[model samples]
Target: MTLTIWIDDWQIQCCGESFAPGDVVSWKLLEVDPEDYADVVGSERAREIDCREEHHGQGEGQDPTPVEVVSVTEVHCRYGVPPGAADTMNCPVPGTTVLVPVDEADGWAKARPDVRFAGYLVTARQVRGGDSDDVSAAELPRSPS
Candidate 1:
């Protein structure tokens, strides 16, 4: 199974299937309020989950822990939203804020294996520190003073 990390409507969440006992997944949960995360319970709480082979034998003793996770985060961007968008009851427009992994422009396109371009035009720009990288001075080299 693969580790999938994405921003849902409420929080930055992650999950993995077919994970065995003692497995661990380390992740950084950003764009989520600390209060909301700490208060997670019920169907959302993943603390000490159980994962074991069913055909091993009759239930006995404590079940093995499914997985362990360690997270560190800072609350920034609007919860599961593109920065600068005003908060409202309506859902944000899809495809307008396509999240891509950090990589070169060509590399990012190659990474999107599931997306296909049928005819619609799309623009790809490098966003560095919430701003366009094209206007950054970091792109230039320094000369001896």
Candidate 2:
């Protein structure tokens, strides 16, 4: 079963660094089974395995690929101006830039050095051409899984 929970007024801890919150950020939660260490199809482990398989014969010319644990749950992020205290997790005003903290950015970066958490920062903008509000849990479709 999957559930959607709202996170508001939170601080994210990066690699020994912390970011203040001021904007609304969305993230997908990836739940991994601890007992099921076998690689799940189409999962990060499977992708890594595919990568290694593709470069198995590349020899010294190939770039080193690092593999790490595939266990991940929730991922959160934020982004550009200094954070001002906000009482809720609502979206910020349009054109507002703020620095957002990415979940496990430091750890992820260590595994994939080319990745940077700063790239997750985003500027807020108005939602157009869709339902901008009223995304209550009751409105979401539920599954029996």
Candidate 3:
């Protein structure tokens, strides 16, 4: 499943530069690392040392989960677009811009070198799509022949 990543934080920069904050980007789910009990206990001990320490959170304290990113997708934002734009995954407008997979961007960039890339740095406003529609393939599994 793909998750939305806000590029408000600087990560990657093109042309020997990085993107600025308030820029919303997309990052696909890659891998997740579960927090260990030992680490949690250690953190708890450290907190104990500082009596004034305040922990604000829920669900398994002192354990931070790690997630690995597969790829970063820059959003091609359009001007005059409403604050509440269509839901990219399920846009209902006939002329509305839609969402696309990031894997397809590499091919598109290579094919059209002169073409501007996505994001605020580029001029594109709509994300191009990847190959394959919403058709399931798990129906036909391979056999151990």
Residue lDDT tens for model 1, 1-145: 1111222222221232222223342222212222222212112321211111121222334333122322211111212344576864433233322333221111112223333211111112223344433322222222112
Q: What's the count of clashing pairs in each model shown?
A: 0, 9, 1
TM-score computed on alpha carbons, candidate 3: 0.22
**Top candidate, metric TM-score:** 3
Q: Global lDDT for candidate 2?
A: 0.25
If both were scored by lDDT, which would come out higher, candidate 1 or candidate 2? 2
After superposition, which runs of candidate 3 have C-alpha atoms over 4 Å from their true positions? 1-3, 8-11, 14-66, 81-96, 104-145
Error of 1 at 16 (Å): 17
Q: Which tens-of-lDDT digit does each residue in 104-130 have in candidate 2?
A: 332232223222222222112212243
Judging by lDDT against the true structure, name the best candidate.
2
Q: All predictions: root-mean-square deviation over Cα? A: 22.2, 19.8, 20.6
Predictions in order: lDDT: 0.24, 0.25, 0.24
Instruction: Give the lDDT of residue 22 in candidate 1.
Output: 30
lDDT of 3: 0.24
Please report, as a residue range, the 10-residue window in candidate 2 with the lowest summed lDDT.
46-55
Look at candidate 1 and tell me the lDDT of residue 75: 17
